[model samples]
Target: MSLAVNASTFDQCLTSIRALPDGTDGIVDNHGNPVNISSNATAISYGLCKEVCGRDSGAFEWSVFSQQFSAWLLPWLALISQLPFGAKHRSDNVMSMLLTVGSPVLGAYSLALTVLNSQWIARRFSGFKYPNVGLAVRALSSLQQVPLEVSAEYGVLASMVVLPENNEWWTELVEGLDYIHTWSISAASSIAWVVIAYLFTVIDSFANVSENIQANGQGVGSVWLWLLPIVIGWLQVSPKCDFDRVAQALEKANRKAYLADYPNPVPLSHKTGRPAFVLQHYRRGSVHRDEESSAPIFNYARFFPWVHAVEQVAEAFERASENALSHVPVGRDVPWAPSDVGVHGDNRKGTLDDVQARPRRGSPIGRWGSDVWTRVIVASALALSLQWGTTGAAFMIVWFTPTKGLGCRSGAYLLYGLISTLVWLIMLLSSIFAHYSHLPHPNSQHLHLRGVVDETAARLSVALRRIGKFVATLNAVWIVVICLFQFSSFFDRCYCDSSVIGLGKRAFYTLLLTEEDIPVLRGAWIGGTLFYYLFDFVRTI
Candidate 1:
């Protein structure tokens, strides 16, 4: 469609058209066909003016201002969001710290993927017909795919080790591998999220560019879309170990040991008329055994491999200290207890009542009051909310936006995005529920509401895990299918005049765009910025 108005008038009409709300239609094409303003804003706007005015208009100018604006803005937002700033406590552990430090590398790798697949870059480099240049581009793009595929493999390993319930062998392997496993899992998780974020960004950017430039071709496709299920599966199967809970358990264990070392018969306190030193063992020997058995073990060796050897040394020192203490004077000089001291039944009963009424040491209520844990929870909630909001927004854009037809590449992306988002939503809800269920609760109280919440959380956890396993298996099959398509040339000849024809052709076309069609630098910029967002989600959640 050609505009027929003068330059000044055309600008005014374009401005007015943009200002009008979506679906407002007075615009028509040269054939007198009504043009929907919302379908393709820029294109329809031009078409509207062309038919309204006669053929004496100055040269028409195409505007890509929206694309330029988003190109500048979105990357910065992704970068800022990816930084390790909000949830500082997450990095206190070794596994998290490794992930944090390796984020930049992952971000760079993602950037490379984005650049290689970018339509904008492809358009610019389409002029280069040299065989050598094409080969170099293909090699670079091929290199970019390797890390992602490797990371996916790592994710599978991590899921197998961490996901199964009551599996002693896997647990032992994880313990034996220790930091090796930690680094591998962290790298896998970071890569999966990074690649996902960048792929999402690339699609969003493509849409923006498409709308801005009025480019009419099949929307981009990617094998990366198949990676979504695997990532979601990884998230579903990964264990949710609350750092705060572990820290509290360790602190409680240390406090118990300290208390255990105190003398059994302690002097009575003057103010409360209670024992100055209350031996937990004296009050409840059986209860102590039960609590110890039930208490969560915070094994340092799982995080820091060196901690195991240190623990052995510490145990030796502890034994020596015990031996020395045992040799020390058994009894200290003190006021002798008279027969009358314990003779009064009322006094003895009052002392027992006071001991019973005393608060249990290291209670859940006290642990929950920690500022660090509170900050961690708030940060996690905010991060998860942001991820859900963004994922929902992307899904809406892809699903609701008007496309050519269901046979087009846009349809494929829409289907992939929809299914992936649904799976992601399930994983997200499971994570949130897991977090809630793991919170410390008062063992003394059996509140109906708490019981209901726990039950609901447990059921959701079980259902999601089952779904995750099924999806993981499906994804494995999907990956094989995608690989067969990538390696085979059978679909190279298949093309639809109206839409993308075969799955192999569509997948091959997307890979080709990454490997040969797009320039290296531009792809890197786009992918890196978008991919960096994975780190933000990984660290915060």
Candidate 2:
């Protein structure tokens, strides 16, 4: 069971031991030559089990900082920040301009994380850099304050009040949009000068540092893995709207006159006032709804509920199965009765979901609330899925490194991440287009409706609303695809472990590494990933 510390010579020794006396050893490397492994790898594996991970399992902190934070959440937050406050997608505005020009925060934070985690950067930066529990909680509270992605649906209603042919509301928005742009442009230009003049070399140095980690396989920065997520927590403290001011402004602009002017804000008719400004807005070369506010962007938020529901159900079944295993009668023990716990949980979830789904009889989620919730749910799922999916794909990229088809893995993952993102728009547009034929359909409850901009916004709005289910389903599919690929691209687990684990040492010695087992190991990896998603998919449905 004793493992030799001299791992460097392990592979060569294994190759010799595995070779049969008559030279019939059949294992080979990627180049394909006779090799040995049958007796060889087993010795090394026994040593690993005896040394590192004994049969007994133990507690390990979730790698939210190292694997999850660095791998996914960090990059995802950076991407989301590029969008304007309360906006879902980035439009051609000052926000996008700022993202392009003064994105030093992005570069700086990314560099800082890598540097902090760099074991080679010196001893100073590499260790337990995450904030304490109290600080992290306060920092996280800032991100959760406004819930821009959730509140975005209110944007449609807000837009109705905020946008008119000639009103302060409309002027404020346009001004706000431009206001952000002017300052952002100015700041970006200033940053660009410094970047051009001095920081280019620093940028190159950072790239070299990153390459060093990737090339030899990022082993150094194990100690300082928790900082970036805390930083992301800091980033979440987005600018919030003062609801008190909003109400005050509403009071100042007398309700009746405000409704008369911004009639569209009132979901139902005012029992008076002119019809909404559908004809007027479209009549001239005024800003198109798509340009001003891509309300459809919020439509995808519907998947949030579905994703939440899916997770709950999956957890439910997983618990049920685990409980069932624990309760199983061991070899002629007395019979056990089925537990009602899982059933009760399911009933409660279904009851609540159905109540919310109906949106009538004083249900909060009915009607317009339902529309908002649906998109919020879906958008949330997509966001999480994108974060995890890209993270998974990145892992896949790292896995394939130093193998024969390394370049192929990079190409495959590039396509995977890009396609997964674009899929949202593709399915969204397709679903909306399909729903167009349905016409002015009744929303969730078939409640009596208003027809202000029905001729204009109704078609697009209804299509967007109806499209949520399809996109939600598609989101589930994309999640499984990326997770499965991630698991499959786990091609180098043994190789990476070779630095320490005895099985890895054995594999390296006997040529029994992942590249050799691709044919059969692929099916196993796929089955495992799908099995993991199965509970999720069933619960979602």
Candidate 3:
């Protein structure tokens, strides 16, 4: 059989493959000359290629598989590349205030919750099972290895990619991503949404401006002018793909490293853990056989040694797998490499003493020793910084503007409250539906406890904990009220005719909200300021 190869290595494996008998479409080099080959040539060819690649048979197979997937990866990436623009441009208006703020909040919340749900599902349903007469084989082959550290890292990386820092590109991407999820479309949808939204909003604004201009023949600067185009351009150019790519690469590297370290690792089962009963039965049977057959004295000792060795092997495998799953320092913080086991000071006694001494006083909830606590702290701080920046801007727009005392207008405030409430309601409903759809049925069974009743109770306990946490953190009612007040418009309306405010809207919402409207715009300012701290509390919990 003919196979493609690099030109430099064309002749390297040819001699070995040329010795087989002739067949239809037989082996040939680039010149297409008939080359004799054997009936079972594929295996030999594969072995030869493996030798050329300097890899084991299995590794070679994996490499080929990765390459094949890589071949198709570009088209897939191209599809993803179209997301922000497809989703954002296709919308009916450019930078809709309702959408700009609502989209990111909804998207960030949903994405965060989805990832949490995935983590919960993976942790809760983890086990091993077998069907029918294949139970023995299943027992030997199926293992439940929980890579807790890896899972935590993956969750952290995912949250970072979804939740970016305060920036224009971030706002566009988040909002764009939210629209994609809300509609469940490809990135191409995002691009289309942006373009469409820009066109319609610009056209509508221009139509109104034209009517005003015609009414008095007043010289009106281009109404929609650069506003819609700038939003469109920002949406189109957002670096969302790079972030996702980096995140995916990290996850893949970590999982690959983990699985490599713990091949077919299984969670310890009660049956597997206690092999004393099996050994006792075997010893009794062996003694009876020896008595009947008059076996040599060495035979019993030999059998015992083999049995003990087997037990040791099983126990060692269990320990290694468990350690890997627990994220006990492997030997490197890098995912693909073994973690540095002794880096945090060997024996863990010193580490424990240091931790106890420090006590981590910033937030009580974040003092947990898990690495997840670090993520919670970092993400919380980031959220806080963004909230403060946005609140500060709103303060300036409302109270410190040069021409107008940033005061709230009644109609605009009403509009702001209405829009915010409506958007939040939709967000809440969508999240509820997403969570509900992912729930396991009520009649689920345990893998290790077919006859045991306590396993069912344990599962229920875990489920209850998860539900309680969700209810407390995802407080839908408070989030709605907070979101309603978060928008600057709720405090003060921007000068309707000022093109500068239109351009600065994203900046205002993101870092510098300066709206001058409503009676309590200043008091509401504190709410925005405190929102991030509260949000962090929710996240850490």
Candidate 4:
């Protein structure tokens, strides 16, 4: 006779199985097939067997296979459904596009900046006076002297260019100065992008792991362990990117040089008992004399009153001699003259119009509201809030979820934090090397010791910069690889029963339900990333 068991008899069956002796005869099926129960069979194995043999076996298997699959798929479907009806899809699409497109664009932009800065630095110090000095030493010297040189040379060259008659060298010098200014701004922008991208990656990685740990009931350390790098890295790198600070520094340097160039006349006497003359005039005359000393000496100005007269006479005589000795075609030998007044009329008129229109541009408050520092402050606040909110949410989820594993997630989370800390440390070391390298060589009685110290610092700075560049390049490549892996894993999770992209993606996405659960975090992440790209782009321009 066939025996039928209902839900109430299921417990009886379990009891009978548990009571059966280890060496007893096994039960037989309807077809008279005998099945032996092993002594090693456990309650878990028996339960699994019942599950497999149950009428709902298909549902049970599907549920087991679709744990992570459904977790992501449902949200994806929801997102897709909202595409035509809501702004949610638009934002999601934009984020996805940025992940796919903006990353490479930013990477290429950074690479270009790196190349340009490298070329500029090399060219800037290529003319070091001492052949014995290494390139690193020259670079350090150039960096240290950049403010002074830019301030002094820019004003002088600019004045020459503004004059009615100027040489090609003056124009080129002015252009070179402009190039340096542009490069400084670009360098600052590049560093900012690097720091922002780094923080973005760290936050995203933490959120990914957090979701998994929370869902799986795993205990991990505080999120501050992950956030500490953000604070430290920002403190180290943000000053480099502050446009206001850079601008103020440049302005102060220019003001100092300007003052030095046109200092107030102070009465003084020469120890040799020469007449008290305007020192500025004396210094200018001496410079002219030194420059022309190789040529036939002109009658030296004996007194202060005779200086300008003597200079004019000497310049005229030299010009006449040069003309007599040189030969040139009549057309090409035309005397140099300033351009006609009419030639600059359009530019002058435009300048006047621009001046007149300035007042109408905006109110003082509006201008202040649009200032660079204002934007920076606002962006920073938004980014910090986003980071904190996302981290807090993750913690809250973990706190409420029933987790079985207590410390399993800590190792991986700490590993990520450790890597970030190491990178920040490298960056800090590089900054320190750069600072020391640019310091003025100390005045000491022991010249040899001073030289050795300076050279050592320069070499270390050079090596550190190279290392930093390599690390930045490697980090960019790593980010690209991670992005690709994530994309592939996303598709694999949706289509395949198992992840085909390897265990890295499998482990990463195991607990992550969706891109993000909170709308604010999802939007903030996208906005913050795009802000970095936009900020860099604007700075570059």
After best superposition, candidate 2 residue 316: deviation in angstroms? 56
Clashes of each: 4, 15, 62, 1
Instruction: Name the runs in model 2 displaced over 4 angstroms.
Output: 1-22, 33-400, 406-426, 429-431, 434-541
Q: Which ten residues in a row have the lowest lDDT in candidate 1?
A: 294-303
For model 4, residues 1-541, the per-residue Cα lDDT tens digits are 1111111213344445445665444332211223356222222122222332232211122332254333322222222221111112243233322221212222122222223333433443344321111322222222221111111122232221121122232232222223122224434454444345445443643464433222221111122222222222222321122223323443333232211011221111211112111111122212122111110001011111122222222222232223222421111223433234312211111121221222211122121112223322333333334333323333333322211111222222323323333443343344344434444544568878777876676566456534543554454344333323322322122111111122222211111122233343344334533443443344335
Q: How many backbone clashes does candidate 1 have?
A: 4
The C-alpha local distance difference test score for the whole of candidate 4 amounts to: 0.28
- List RMSD in Å for every model shown: 22.4, 25.8, 33.9, 22.7
Per-residue CA lDDT of model 2 for 409-508, tens digit only, reads: 3443444344434444443443333323323446535333334333344456445433432443444344334333332323223333222221232332
Report the C-alpha lDDT of model 3 over 142-199, residue by residue, as the tens digit: 1100001111122221111111121222233223332211223554464455445434
Distance from true location, Cα of 423 in model 4, Å: 2.6
Measured against the true structure, the TM-scores of the candidates, in listed sequence, are 0.29, 0.31, 0.23, 0.28
Q: TM-score of the candidate numbered 4?
A: 0.28
C-alpha positional error of residue 519 in candidate 1 after TM-score superposition, expressed in Å? 9.5
- For candidate 2, which ten residues in a row score worst on lDDT? 217-226
Point out where model 3 deviates above 4 Å. Answer: 1-98, 101-104, 107-320, 323-388, 400-429, 444-541
Which runs of model 4 end up more than 4 angstroms from their true locations? 1-418, 442-444, 469-541
Give candidate 3's TM-score. Answer: 0.23
